[model samples]
Target: MASTVATNLNTLGRTTFIKNPSFKATPLNAYAKVLSKFCIIPSIEGPLKVVQQIEQQGAQTVLETVGLKKKGYAVKSHTLVKHNLATGQTGQVTAQDVSDAEYLAPVTIGSPGQTMNLQFDSGSSDLWVFSSEMPADQQQGVQSAGNSIFDPSKSSTFQRTHGTWSITYGDGSGASGNCGTDNINIGGITIKNQIIELADTASSQFLSGSESGLCGLAFPPLNTVKPTRAQTPMVNMISQSDIPKDSELFTCYFSGQSGNSYFTTGYIDHDACGGATPAYSPVDSSQGFWEVKSETACINGKAVSRSGNTAIVDTGTSLCLLEDSLLAALYGALPGAKIDHSVQGWVYPTDTPITSIPKLEIAVGSNYFTIEPEYFGFADLGNGYTYGSCQSRGSNFPFDILGDRFLCNIYAIFDQGKCQFGAVQRTSSGATTSGRPVDSGTESSTAQLVH
Candidate 1:
């Protein structure tokens, strides 16, 4: 019966169109805060293994806290690992893990509508928040950061649930919490009975930000609820009877400039793309991501072919991560471009002429979109070098990640009902390179680049 239900959900189809409202994304500008949000990508096998370990640990912890034990359940041995670029070593460490969150949106929850800032993440699928249920020390940290905490007691419609959830990222940062159901509103769209994870414990990293929580836009299977998986807000939103049949998709527009980024649901902003229609590609959600295949990339207007390169359209990530071979080919064409081990990523001399930088492009199905040269220089290294926005995924990570660096150049669409990913180039002058310029004296000296 469970298998049948899952199959039916996966095979649900989209119907015709209706227009809906959009929400603006608030860009974070504090250099220190932005640096703290850099995402550390784990090796190919690391995430799955870590997730399995966390699930088992979370289930065990929940049982112990509730004073209940399941028959024949045993804890499995597992270790959380991350690469230390500064030390050139792999080590076991517990640190505040950071997600690649650059933008935030205001979301309202509960009956009377308690609004809080939430980082919208397409790479993850759990809607979690800092809550009053956490330890006093943790609550203090959240307060210090000026972030709001969800007080379920204040919400008349809040309903407590039996499930618990815990999740650890590749960077060893994690959050564990109890579950509840409430009404959630985003951009004038309301989703009833949305599962909300209220954190009882959170790593210090999450407590150091203004954002109170995360609103995950990924597929339902990635939700961390235990004993029974719960649907994400996006899933619930689509399932709502009031939502228009045509509005089962969402679109993201990152202008690379502050105050201009926003997202729309149930409709596409064709004006943003200068009336260009998006080129669509089938999405493979088996892995619970917006995954698609890319076989070609362009360097200096020259086509470079590579096969079996699956890419994830992840807005949660800040940089564009490509396969090693493709990265080498792209960087090799530029003189003095090298992967600096100190930073553990590619960097070029700050004095390098922008005209000398080769034109770069990545394909989405049959459509190829150009990545502007300005985006190539991601950050200044303070020592006469600038970091490259496009980096290698290393030999272990199995797929390419088209993150914000790529998304800034196009209008991206995630059609859940149709199981498709779409993109169209943004030719408007309004779209600019990401990141505001800082004085050379205050430039970031070290980068936290992990693979």
Candidate 2:
């Protein structure tokens, strides 16, 4: 029965497979991956403690750049500790390594179709890739990692443009490249002459990853192209005359079980929602994210309120991050749950029964959807502890972020034409039942979900 629903959802629209073939769900790895999405480099001091420090500082910089806070907002800085492998001692370090991405989807580019797996990020707004134009050493490293590199010379449809793009992370690592336009396709939906950033130089962090690049789904204003900003693929899809007016939206369904997650563009997967109507709230894209108001929450069926709070629905992030007070309140309700500084997040004994975890519900507009208890435990921290999915957004970040941890429990919709975000609860019989990871197979493309 579940297989039938999954098939029906895939067939209803242009769908793309979502998977992280190399990702392992360890607490350190999960936390590091989430930090990398925010451009934060995890420190070698310790897994959890350093991540918390880095996030506090990095979030402040990000919030300030987006105009969410005053330029000189007071932010505490932590000295990054670097361990010397040979000396077995820790010292101050300038840079830290990035973790592997959580998920990636196949995107076809150019005339003959050069398909590369890209990390689809809703929190950002740039579609950039490692290209053939990069330095030989960098290209070889990226290629050796089983990642595809785009060669503009091979694609007859590719056209070079005047703009240049560069993105630097907090750790001094960055990517810089030239710009071009070509036919780009995802889930069988093609957008011609879409702006593509071809990286000629990339940091080692990006070159070692399985993903070729990133497909940012946020608003156009967030695009980082120099001199003149370019429209993102999502924006181009909406403006293109070839795409139908009603087909301007995209939906994401992430399964708890591997090999089942898929993304659909051009229509909603009603079957994935189990006949429940999606409740939507107007988006505030001024800050260039899928932002919506979410001021209320319920923990263990008890009302918890915070006025004027908003959340960014970001699929790129691995865990659901909320304000510290909200996190304290939620975790406080669960017996044995405590803020474990060792992991720099809330955690409980691994032996605790699932029924013992308190119920948590977050609001989307006026409607509140319950987050299944199965998602309560995020990653396993060896030594009899399990990290909680709900973590502190910290003092620096201005808004709460609803990442895959919260997203897995619902059928999410990103309506570009309407400028709103919507979601509906998934029925018990849905493709995924928990946040636990399952063994996955090798990557493959399927037309079963394509329009």
Winning model by TM-score: 2
Q: In model 1, where do residues sit more than 4 Å from their true spots?
A: 1-100, 428-451
Where does candidate 1 have its weakest 10-residue lDDT segment? 1-10
Clashing pairs in 1: 247-266
True-vs-predicted CA distance for residue 76, candidate 2, Å: 11
Give the best candidate by lDDT: 2
TM, every model? 0.78, 0.84
Give stretches of model 2 more than 4 Å off. 1-13, 39-65, 70-97, 427-451
Q: Tens-digit lDDT track for model 2 on 9-84?
A: 3423465565776776656455555554454333223432322243344322232235544223332333323444
Residues 195-289, model 1: lDDT tens digits: 99999999876787557888888876667788787897767767775344654777888867554788776666546556455677888776567
TM-score of 1: 0.78
